[model samples]
Structure formats: C-alpha cells, structure tokens
Target: MTDHTPHTNHDSNRPAPDQPRASRRGVMKAIGAGAAAATLGIAGISPAAATPDVSLPTDEFVETDGTEFVIDGEPVYFNGANNFWITDDDANAATEERVDAVFDLFDELGINLVRIWAHGEAKEGELVLQPEPGVYNEAALEHHDYVIEAARERGMKLIVALVDNWDHEGGMLQYAEWADAESRYEFYTMDETREMYRNHVETILTRENSYSGLEWRDDPTIAMWELANEPRLEQDDVPNDMDDLEPPEHQEILGEWIQEMSAYIKDLDDNHLVSTGSEGHYYGHWEDDYPDDDWDGQDYLEHHSYDTIDAASFHLYPDHWGDNPADPDDRLSLHDGADYITERVEDAHNELGIPAYLGEFNVNLYDHDLETRNEFLEEWYDAADAVDCNAVIPWQVVLEDTQDHDGFQLYASDSGSIIEDYAEVVAEKSGDWDGDNGNGDEETIAVGEYNTTDTTSDGLHNDFTGDGETTHDDVTAFFENLEDDGVQDNPEAFDFAENDELGFTDVVELLRQV
Candidate 1:
C-alpha cells in the first residue's frame, strides 16, 4: 500500500497564519450543537453567537438521469475533492477546527462535492470507527455525523466510502485477521469474514444521526455510498504493482462480494445511489473469456452489472500508473492520460448507460511544479467536459497547515492560486450545462418527474401490498419475512443482511429507512 500519510515537517507544531485558532474541544462542542450555527463561523466570533441566519435547502437530493447526475430534477455538475481525513477517527489527526476551515475553503472555491471515508479499522495504533468485529465507537460515529451535517450546511454533497482497500486504518485484511484467515482474499470468500463485513455495513447504513435525528439512509446530504476505496485483491510477491498484477480467483470473489453488498445497501435504503469504487483497471482476462472469469467477475464492466450499482467510478494517477519520476521516459504525459480518461468516460456512458466519475486523480507535485500540475488538471477537466463526465474529484484537498507533501496537497500557496482559477472554469462550465450562466437560478422539475432506472427485480417485491410504492405495508411485510423464513422470498429484493438470507438485521435496515 502507498504511504499516504503526510510527511512530517519540523515546523508543523506551529500553526499557519490562516489556520483556525479555535480549540478542538470547543469546535467539537459547536459541531454537536448544530453545524449550521456553530461550524460556519470565522475567527473571533463566540460559539454561542456564531449561528449564521442561513437556511439550507432540505429537499434537494441527487439522482441519475441517464448518464448524468440530476439534483432536484435538473442535471447537476460538479468539481470536487477527496478529503479522507475529515472523518478521521483520531481526534488529533483531524481537528474539528481544521475540518471547518477545510469546508470553508471548499465553500469559497465552489467545490460542490467531497468524498470521505466512512469506515476506519483499529489496528497499527490508529484510531478507528469499528474497534473490533461487530463493535463500534460512538464518538467516532458522532464525528462522522458532524461531517455529514457540516457538508449539508455548506450546500455540498458527499460520497462516503464504506471501507478502505488498503491497510491504512484497517480494512478487508483486518477482517480476515479477525476471522483467522490465511489471506486477505478470505475476507471475500470466507463466510465468517464476509459476515463481519456485512455487520459493519448494516451498522453504518442503519446508524441514526446523533445530531440530525435522521438515519443515514434518510439523509439526503449523502450523494452515494461507495463500496470501498479503490478495492483490489492482493497478489503474491508481485511487489504491489496495481497496473501489472493478476488475481483471477480473487477477482471473482470480489465480484460476488460487490453484488452482495450493493444489493444489501439498496434493500436497506433505495433512495441513495451506490458505486463499486473500483479503480477501473482493464484486465486482459476480462476480454479473453478466461475460464472462471465469468460475467460476475470483477472486471470494470461486470462490477456494474448488479442492479443496485448506480454509477461507475475510477481513479487516475498518471504519475503512479506510468511510474513517472522513476522512469520519466516511459511516463504517461498529461495529454496521454487525458485521452485515456476520455475513452473510459465515453465507454462508461455508451456501454453501461450510467454516469461515470473520475473519483480520484492527481499529478505528482514532487515531480511536477504547481504550473505543470495546473496544466495537467486543466487538460483533465477539459477532457471530462468534452465527454460530459459526471464529476472530477482530485486526489485530495487539505488545509495549508497540515500539508506533508507538495504533490497531493491542494492548499499550498501556488496550487491554491491555480485552483482558484480552475474553480472559476468549473463553475462556469457547470452553470452553462445547467442553463444558469454560473448563477444559481436554474429551475427544477417536480419531484415526480425524477427518472428512476429499472431495478434488478420485477414489481414491488418489497413494496409488499403492490401499491406502486414502498410504505408502511412494506415495513410490515419485511417483519413478516424476517419471522417466517429469516429470508425474503426474493433475496435480491429484501435481503439487506447480505447473509444469503435475512433476519433481525434486515428488519433493522427496513425500519430505519421507513
């Protein structure tokens, strides 16, 4: 796994001039009280008096219209960033004050969306959300709730990834360890390990917001639930080269897991969309029709085959993919990467019929300076625009104070200057697409006009009374199914437990959404 931790600076102990001066505990207290009133304040205002008289739009939720994201029944476009640290379980790793400052920067820059990690594992001395299998930390969950509410207050949407593929903050491998499995791949195939994961998913989806009085499934601030962050299986002795590795059996196992989890999340709450969170790597085996590489395998296309998956996502790292600085001669140029992204975006739209997201991308700032990075991002933005891709969230956005490296951090002085310009371009392009000329004045269609794609199963399997909608009747039927068979007749429709069957957890999932 790549070491994403920021490089330590000798002067890191000193706060930057622009860093927030508030104490972490004070900020957390404010966040818990209410995000709209407490977390939006600038320096010098008392937390009690920091409440802004802003009214956030409560009804706007994002859905898909063909290959585009429709918000409030109108096509929505965005430029976003990944701030995985916002939901940091370690209170010291990410302070509440810094979180506020980061969102403040996002608001200033017109970043409409963010991707945050919703799962963290307790291992390697790191603070984690789930300290053990089937165990959770309430304070950690509250911190995440603060992030969701805080984002909503800022008019920004979030894509919350359920877990990490890498070892950082404990991931699939940790679950396998808990199950005493020999390999991380066991997390997918082993019944005990898979159950641990299912339990975690259920815990997350059914969790009620400590602050909002709403369950996570009912929260519209969340745009989607990502299955994992760049999920890939381990290969033996291959030196962890992501682009040049093979794991045929592991691929199949992951595919099954994805289908199971995607269906499980949908059964819990059909409102929000789900993404596979694959890195969009192409494997020759996928095309060669290799034995056991069936349609249910973990190919870029097959990962989206499940009815519950609403979008395709991929990450781009031209520098890493090409081993740029190590072998500059063989590195993929900015234009080359753009061409690759354009093709993938086109394929996603043409073949899958679902929107595609450039979920993560970044040029190595260590190798390229701010100007070159800016050029790279501009070319990528242009390429995405040419194909009408749904969104582009760079590898990361961080506060100027916490930056450990020049390449990944967008808060550096030079990069911040470049991003200010890039933000304007994105805002203008998005505004034109929405027919608002960069102003927030576009009219939205009625909620009933929102287009919903066909689900995997036919005809209100969970709708119980066949009333053309999911309501209280379905809730009653859910309980009945749980009591009678411990599984829905059509497992694909109401099997939220992801245990190949259902029981009490499925009931919890149904009632929370209802």
Candidate 2:
C-alpha cells in the first residue's frame, strides 16, 4: 500500500490470460450479488447487488491496483492518443472548436484516455500557460480548461503532464530562463526554480475550471498527473546543452526529485493518480541493443517505486532508439521493440506492481512505408499485452487539420483505424480484466454486482491468423479472408458484432489478444 519503498514482488505476476475468449451478445448481470464473494481489501467495492462489490481505490479516480487500472470497480484497458498542441493557446476562436473536434474523433475511435501537456511557458512572443513566475495567462488557461471540460462531456479521462523535457513550447529551458538558473538542469535542483515549478503545479491544482464548475484537483475526468514528459537525468541529457553530471548520482538526484514532485502533486490533488512520465530506458536487460547504458535517467523500478506514484509510463520509438540493424534500414527490429516493451512493462506491472503504460510510440512512416509501420506496431502492441500492460498510447494523434510535428504525427485519417482496432481488442475482454488481478486467486466467489461476464471460450477465438495468439495480423487476415468461400458460407463463426453476420466490426475485434 505504501508508495515509498513499496515492495512489489506480487505473490506471482498474473500471466496474461491464455485461454481463448468466447464472446456473448451482452454482459451477464448480478455481478455484485455474486453467486459468491471475495475482496481486494480496498474500501469501496461492495458485495451488495446495487454496489457490485469489488476493490475500489481510496477515492473515485482512476487508480492503480497492482497491474490493473480500476474505476468504479471496473478495470480500464484504454487505447489512447496524445496531442500536445491542444492547449497551445492559439488565441483563435476556433481553439474551442478544435478541442471539441479532437474529443469527437477520440470518441468516434473508442479512445478513453488522452495525454496532454499542461506546461506552455512564455517564449519571445507566444501564448502560454505561465507567462511569468506565479503568473498565468487566462487565454491559455481557457484553452486548457475547455479541453478538460470537453473531455469530461465526452467521457474521456486525461493524463495531464506538468512540464516537458523538450523546448518545443518553452519547457525546462524556459523555466530555467524564468528563474535565471545557471542551467536547465537547475530546473530540477535549484530551490528557486523548484519553488517556481511547484507554484505552477499549485496554480494548476488549485484552479477552478471555468467551463466545468469543478476544481481541477477534484475532477475524476483527469485520471493522472505526470511530473514531466520524457524526463531525463543530466547525465543522459548532457547533449542538450547540459553539463555532464556524475553517474548514479544523477540518477539519485532525479529519483529524489520524482519522489518530491509526485508527493507534492499527490498532496495537492489526491483525487487522481501520479506517474513519472519517463521513457523507462532499461540497461543491463538485453546485452546486444539494450546494453548496459544509462541512456535515460529513468531507472524504471526505482523511479516508479515512489509511494504516491500510481503508474509507470514509458515511450517507444524504435526508429529513434534502436542501436543495431534489425530492419532493412538498420533500425531496431520488431522483436527488439517487443523485448524492450516486455522488460519495462514486466518491471513496472509485475515487479513494481503498477499499471505500465506505453505513453508514446510510433513506427516511422517517413523511413518506411505505412504498411511496414503498421506491421511493427502490431508486434509492439502484442508485446505490451504479453506482459499484461493495459494501455499503449501513441504519440501525437492529431486532427487532420493539426500540424504534424517530429515526423510522429498520427492524423485521424491515416492512423485512426489503428486506434479503433486497439480499442476493440480491449473491449472484447470487457469484464475479464476486473478481479483477475494475476494474484492467482480464484475469487472465492463471483457474488458482486459486476465482474460476471465470461469472455474465455473453448475454441471460438478471433485469432484469424492462426498464429496461436491473436494480434494485428489477425485483424488483417480476417479482412483479407472475407472473400474466401469458408468465410462467405459461415459468417456466423466470425461474427464479432454478434448480429449473426460478419462485417468490419468483426475484423476490428481480431488481433486483440495475442
């Protein structure tokens, strides 16, 4: 229960459900009034029929329960997208419309979670969240407020990161300049800069949402707060005009900062969860590509162990991180990306016993064709699921109108299909992720108001590829096979829609399980 020095060795890590799932038309009832009952020791899950007893977080926010994320006693497996420009504060009349459009697209795609930046520091001449220390821009704040309210209206949960490591919209560099720190690294260490940073955090935590009439700190729609995006220790980030600090010491310093900042945010807002938004670089895991290198300050296990932190987040850009040649372009292979994801997720979800999220990932289409990128994405998605990691949020899924940045932009038109497919995969297992917390405990009884659906079937799997596991390839194969005689004659076997017919909806449910 303690976040500080939390001991995470679960009784045994819950292995990903291996049994193929059988889907019925709808969820069975009486989940709370289980034919039997058991508990996860939290306060809220009730055994009563109306209450549907299951473990709940101490509060009604998206919370970490070991490797699962639960809300109102239901496990949430989200297919998410990120858009850093949502709060750009463009000062245009269309900003609110832009926010609505983005949320509308997310809803259309079944995306339940989104990651957006909360920090937009002042630049030479630009709109920003904080124009000066202890000062904020209402226009900028309005744009952000609208995003929160719009997401609330659309039933979306958000992960709002406090700052950025990059200087895209004046990140740590701007903070360093604001406080006149000797270096950007001082943003993490200098007392004055630290206070400024905390002041910004407080400003956000205490602000009243102009649109929602709800305090930012109390909104359940805001699922989690990230300390920063892709934060790195001075040692690893030395290339970015930072002076090299000593080894391990830099890690310790950043670790202390994460400890302090996470606790600080938790104190200001206990209604939501907190995470270290690190790219969770793993050293000494795989000898070849993942050699013993301190590429990022994120020692995954150590940083995520902070008691108040609820989730462990990492990003994947194999095109950027791969050292050896796995593909024709000498990039990291699909297997390399898979191993990287598995190690980090297992460490956080299994070893640290927190939900592991791939907060940003993309296979570059600039380097390869979209087909190649799609193929790699499937391998990575299965890798995360292979370790029971719930969410894999791609970097920068933007509206077709938004400008694509960093060659990682995923426009709704091109990559939106991937998001829809991922959502369907998790949706197919709707109630299965609930109390099956990998504790190896057969809930003594199923006597709750919920958690009553049975998804696993003997042989009726959507594993269309026959790869022995369901994955994105199956999604493709199911579509490709629609013209085959077997599929034409027996559409019922592929009826994911449960309408006794086969269609695109059925294909969306494939490649979900591997």
Worst 10 residues of 1 by lDDT: 447-456
Please state the error at residue 226 of candidate 1 in Å: 0.5
Model 2: per-residue Cα lDDT over 440-509, one tens digit each: 2232212111111111232243433222233334444555555566565656555665667765445434
Tens-place lDDT digits, model 1, residues 1-514: 2455634431223243232333323433223222312243423222231111111234466799888887666566767888876777556666667677778777655577899988878643234689888889887888888888788766678898987878777887787778876555666778997788788888988899988988988898889999888776644412233243355665666778898989988888888999988777654444443211332234777777678899998877766656443344554555576776887788789998999998988777777777788877777777877788788888787765665444576663545544445455554444232232222223221112221111112211333433222333444454543434323344554555455655555543433333
TM-score of each: 0.70, 0.69
Residue 299 of model 2, lDDT score: 77
Each candidate: how many clashes? 1, 25
Q: Identify the runs in model 1 with alpha carbons over 4 angstroms from their true place.
A: 6-57, 124-127, 234-248, 285-298, 325-333, 421-514
Ten contiguous residues with the weakest lDDT in model 2: 1-10
